[model samples]
Target: MRREQVLVFDADDTLWENNVVFERVIAQFLGWLDHPALGLPERRAVLDEIQAANAVTHGYGSGMLIRSFADCATRLRGRPVTAAETAEIAALAAVLIDHQVELVPGAADTLARLGVRHRLLLLTKGDAEEQRRKIDASGLAPYFQALEIVPEKDDAAYRRLITAYGLDPAESWMIGNSPKSDILPARRAGMNAVFIPHAHTWVLEHGEVDASDPGVLHLGALTELVDHF
Candidate 1:
């Protein structure tokens, strides 16, 4: 049997619905933005491109997403956006603020089962308030021994978590869907990692993973953790 160890989890796509909600809101915005010349795919490309540039400066969350929508519409229309259009775009995100947190299938049960033997820590990065709000809503917060919300989950962030938690890098594992934020960085910090790819993972979090990586394990779903750990 494996030894009891620290398990760090990414909260957004890993635990509950996040980017999917944004995608739904964006779809609604796009429907409203039906352009005379551009097709749906072309319109989506414009928004995606604008978000790639704006995400670095604006950071993340619904507010930044709304900004990207406005910027996209402005660029598409070739004119400064009116207050009405901005308000309509803002309403899309406003509805997003109230979207209920939907946990991944068996997430709560898996956390409960694992918590009995291992320490579980939630290590999600995003707007602090937004992250916390989701945490509060998920009802899975009780499973975590502690939670750390940050702007980004980089290698340094992983290293810092180790220092703060007094975790043994070899004994610890990071669990989540995103390879960029969860798997690779944890491996770099000398911890083992489990990659469970999500279908609708944010474009920014995509990263290639090698199947032969020494300590990285890939799983089909969250419930499968029960058998492994």
Candidate 2:
């Protein structure tokens, strides 16, 4: 049980819910897409297909979702949609995108407790503006010394953080929700990982692993983080 130095945390599902809002927006889009001529199931199928394809290219974001909807609308309408129509679609997106930061239960308390001793850093991946907006609105920004908003959480991300912070991987811990993004990669980098599961995690964030490793740990809630160390 070597003493820990730096503790990095993921921002999205780790601190708050992200994909749940996406799911709500997708549902709203599906309802709007359905008409007398277009069946809901058929429209949903097309959306799913487009989203699957878009995941390969855009990864994840409101922009990608809106673009996919615009593309689908164009194919169905047989005519170019007006700017007004695009605005309507994007307006539906705004409801979720404009949402205030709703922290996961106990996130603030846990972070406050942990901030007392460890060097805390936020390591997350998402659109720069949106991620920053959420961080700012969450009122939790002050807890972290810095943030590393990356495109992907991989071995490279871990190496970069270690180098940037001048930290020993063995003495640093990565606390996050996604096993794919946080646990496996951190373990591979020889850092301890603490996984706090969120109910509505994105599918792409899933990855295979044995959580029994000394370097890997899982918790049910964010507050459990304080006890792990």
Candidate with top TM-score is 1
List the global CA lDDT of all models. Answer: 0.89, 0.82
Clashes of 2: 0
**Pairs of residues clashing in candidate 1:** none
Worst 10 residues of 1 by lDDT: 54-63
Candidate 1 lDDT over 157-210, as tens digits, reads 999999999999999999999988999889989999999999999887899887
lDDT value, residue 35 of candidate 2: 59
lDDT of 2 by residue, 123-211 (tens): 88767887888888989989999977886788988988899989888888898878788988998888988877778877667787685
Model 2 misplaced stretches (Cα beyond 4 Å) = 35-49, 52-59, 74-84
TM-score, model 1 to reference: 0.95
Query: Backbone clash tally for model 1?
Result: 0
Error of 2 at 205 (Å): 1.6
